[model samples]
Target: MTGHDDWVPFEITPGNTGAEATARGLTAYLQGLDDLAGLLTRKKALVFRDFGVTPEELDVVMDELLPNRLAYVHGNSPRTKVGKNVYTSTEYPQEFTISMHNEMSYAYAWPSRLLFFCQQQPGTGGATPVVDGVRWLAALDPEVREAFKDGVRYTQNLHGGMGLGKSWQDTFETQDRAEVESFLATTGSTWEWKADGGLRVHQDRQATIKHPVTGDEVWFNQADQWHPAGLGDETAKALAQIMPAEDLPQNVTFADGTPIPAEYAVQIRDRGLDSAVDVDWRTGDLMLIDNVAVGHGRRPFTGARRILVAMCD
Candidate 1:
């Protein structure tokens, strides 16, 4: 029930149950321990104003509150920042939308949490939208769920670099065939080389993975996002011709060799969009999100806008 003039924390309606505010300073506010648990339990996100906390204080708060976790740093800082040249194809340079999926969904490892801090708000557009992955998965038909439970597959071109500006080779630090093969093996994926010298890998992972904390089977992968590789260009091109974009399910395949059912894709797309909520950014507002239950992306913006992010475990 206690509050301060400089700090105004309130919950956004609907999807989010947490509190947020733009405050004058962060050190005292962050150090107060009484409300920390409640804030975390109820409101998974907290937005605050920049209060000129020194690097030492910032590190203390981040360490105490977030523990050992990766923070997606952006812009120039004494610490770390995402390089300016990095681009993301999964979303785009334009206002196109990205599908809902956990970060690093194609990889064997994924971050447990994520934090996005907005240093500047765009003149227009570029809303950060998020969806509840668990709820979205729970609403699926039992039969459809079963089909996915059989396994979910993803096909990713190891060379395109998606939007991260760095190709898989660059990210992984080696193009050696043995190293690539070893990486794929750890991900439990199957892959092949393209005639053009690209590598395509497929991962037929379980649609539902037991949550490490809750021990509940949560839906994890979306089928339409991936495809199979290794087929000759002629055959691959032929299949591409015969199939619809969603129907081809090129990335991952079933044990029986079927693509993900189109109906399921439609369902996921509709539900994901329906469940999504957007966070409008204000300068100095920092937002933390539970990546397991929520997926997030940015809206296109014009003018000078800056945001910093750190993915937390």
Candidate 2:
């Protein structure tokens, strides 16, 4: 994409696909297309609109999009698993906007693509905005970009069943501690199990990543979302007053553990949103995004809305 104005996703409707309004039609159209991954990397995002894909046909449509669907394991967002590998998109309050960040960018491994299916439309707003990671990085102030060159450190304090944020069980999607440890071992992360049945984990990762196929270096960390400043004044102050930085449910800092300035976090969050293209949802709409190339977030809305999300490697 050249810039924000030219960075909108490539939309495929009935006109482009020459298909009927059915899931089987979508699958056939996709099955005939060559190098879908190449197209996704070039377009960054894809919209399959007016397909009228029913929930019963979701799995087939998703299989055509890409296979090896992944569970939302180790995900930090507030969500509910409603299917084998599908989840109700971020359950953050409808009145509040969620900042842009790649799905699971804070972790050691992340999905290559994310598919969102809108099961119900909201009364107003609730658009899923996507930001081109390259453009997002380019829009940031040079000083801010330079400061994050070395990447950042992330900390998570997951409780057993009670306390702040997400519980270890929900975070890992398993009751077996051995499974959790086995997963963590592959991430090169350090973790501690507290006497109170809490899990504290620390991981350091780079601020940017290069796409495997396109070889494009893009902004790829969740620093702003993990930092206190990004949590808004009231929440940040309340958390700080209650415990030290390391004790928070989630926290981030410079790779060296130095605090990231509130202003930096603001610039990062605001710039990403500013450069985003909002994809308004309609019932039965489906969207697929190349997770590394584009980061996504939600716009505030009203009334009932349900978007199911699934990802693939």
Candidate 3:
């Protein structure tokens, strides 16, 4: 089967039997799977609408429609409306732009798939954009790609805000310092002290990793995005000269102690943003995207905009 340009729309009538509606919904999902699988190798996104079902009902249908368990659930609310808060709520109202990067790149375990349900769309702006991370990485300079392949290290300080108001001391209240150090060491990360006296840990991770399914290397890391260790205002200003606005004050280094150029970092950011395709959302619309292949973000909107998100592995 080939992919279709138009999305399949269905309506559940009041007179239709429950079983009949379910059968039809399942059929649509199957058709979508067939079409998506034929066109893409690693991922496919399907938009569903007018299924005449509540979110709870859709959950049941999705359980059967997709083979894997729904893994990551998130939202754009002031507080988390669904699953865990990966980042602190303090970063709310921050307008995110679409960039090509894997979900949870820093985590030891990352989700292989992602799904987003748009409960409400903004009156203006706030489009959902996605990009192919693998494709974009391949287009980078050979030297740049090689440097990334050599592995890179980043420092993530999950002490205060990232820990969601839990200080480093609080998080390890029961655990021994040696044990915490061992855990960080096992991850190839180092630690330091923040100027304000909070614990600042340096975490080293891969800059490029092979997709579990596609076996192609994708550039992955959030080194340039947000800094783990909160830097002092004066120190931050000085580091701004050396690093891009996107790269935080924390140092980023190659496995062999080589520093990644600020220019290259900007290139990666630009390419990621360039590859993304935005979906103009409508109220009550559900948009599903492949997290492994695509990175998603939002535009700032005035007034209220309700959106719900669910991530499936």
- Tens digit of per-residue lDDT, candidate 2, span 1-313: 4554468999999887789778878888899998899899899999999988888889899998868899898899889999889999999989999999999999999999999999998999999999998899888999999999998999999999999899999999999999999999999899999999999999999999998887878899999999999978898898889999999999999999999999999899999999999999998889999999999999999989889999999
Clash numbers, per candidate:
19, 0, 1
Task: Estimate the Cα RMSD of every predicted model relative to the unseen true structure.
Answer: 8.4, 1.1, 7.1
lDDT of 1 by residue, 169-209 (tens): 55455657777788668777778876655566666566667
Give the higher-TM-score candidate: 1 or 3.
1
Worst 10 residues of 2 by lDDT: 1-10
TM-score rank, highest first?
2, 1, 3
lDDT per residue (tens digit) for residues 260-300 in model 3: 67667667766666655666666655555555555555555
Clash pairs (backbone) in predicted model 3:
155-203
Give the true-structure RMSD of model 1: 8.4
The numbered model that scores best in lDDT is 2
Which candidate comes out best when scored by TM-score?
2
| Global fold similarity of model 1 (TM-score) | 0.67
Cα error, candidate 3, residue 181 (Å) = 7.5
Where does model 1 exceed 4 Å of error?
Answer: 1-24, 34-42, 49-66, 69-91, 160-166, 171-179, 193-195, 215-217, 227-250, 300-306
